[model samples]
Target: MNALMLLVQKLSCDVEEHVFSEVSLAIEKPESYFEKFKERLDERGIDSPIDQLAWISLVDALLDHDLAFELDWKESGLYICDVVDELLDRKKMAYISWGDFEDEEFDELPTSQCLNEISGKLKEVGISLAYLDIDSDSYVLITVPSSDIDDIKKMAQEAGYSIQDSF
Candidate 1:
């Protein structure tokens, strides 16, 4: 119900017939995620206009489940990809999410390997892991969820990464 969601919904509708509306309505049926998201945003005191828009983009992506990777990529076991080409601004780090996995899977090495691959790509663009959150039956905010920054950096460096921007 936020302005950015409205804009995205309107844009999606304009370009793709009824696709956006149907998706939006479906997502709204279970309102817990949206409600918690609003609370998280409020707690962060995110008053900036750009941050607001980013939040909207995040929500829209979540609603659509439009982030499934190709068979080739999924088989490679990675869960994210560079979306820099799709970014409106070069300075902003853009990434496309892959399909969701259960929260328990996140703590495993294979999962981190997948995430690390994506993080490796992002680091090439001077971006590090900002954070990742999951909102399904349980709403959670995972800030620096990884066990060690050194480990992440080592993995990234092994993947031919550059200096990541300070978050």
Candidate 2:
């Protein structure tokens, strides 16, 4: 078996306790809906990173089944608030896998980045990857095959996020 499987099997032997030293980490840009959306933005010269990130995340929130929105953007904007240009930093929140990028990809054509850096990293470390759903302003992590919901919940909670079951 590969190193990751071996590690999992070994660590799982105890079922109670084991000490690990360190972790190693390792994304493919998929031809997903969000990718196509990015292309559309490129074609139209939507060059602003903030705009790109926003539209990309919005498209992710809309098109990707892995990312379902509990509260529609329009409803929140029209009834509660207004759309504005706000950016967090070099990192932007994205709902689709493609929307998330590795630090290395920042220099490349924004249209070309991995599907989901987080999932890729998790899978590399023998951890199951969970899909994220947008619950209004926050995100909910839904477990996939081989995933630990509790583990995923812990990570999200640490990041100041909460979980929801509904789509």
CA lDDT of each candidate? Answer: 0.35, 0.30
lDDT by residue (1-167, candidate 2, tens digit) is: 33322332322222212211111111122233335456544643554343124323332432233222222322221111111001101112222322233234332422112213334533553433332433334332322323454544454355344333222
lDDT of 1 by residue, 27-58 (tens): 45424443434554454453333322343434
**Model 2 C-alpha RMSD to native:** 18.9
Question: For candidate 2, what is the TM-score?
Answer: 0.22
Estimate candidate 1's RMSD in Å: 14.4
Q: Pick the candidate with the highest lDDT.
A: 1
Per-residue error (Å), model 2, residue 54: 10
Give the TM-score of each candidate: 0.25, 0.22
Off by over 4 Å in 1: 1-58, 61-79, 82-109, 129-132, 135-167
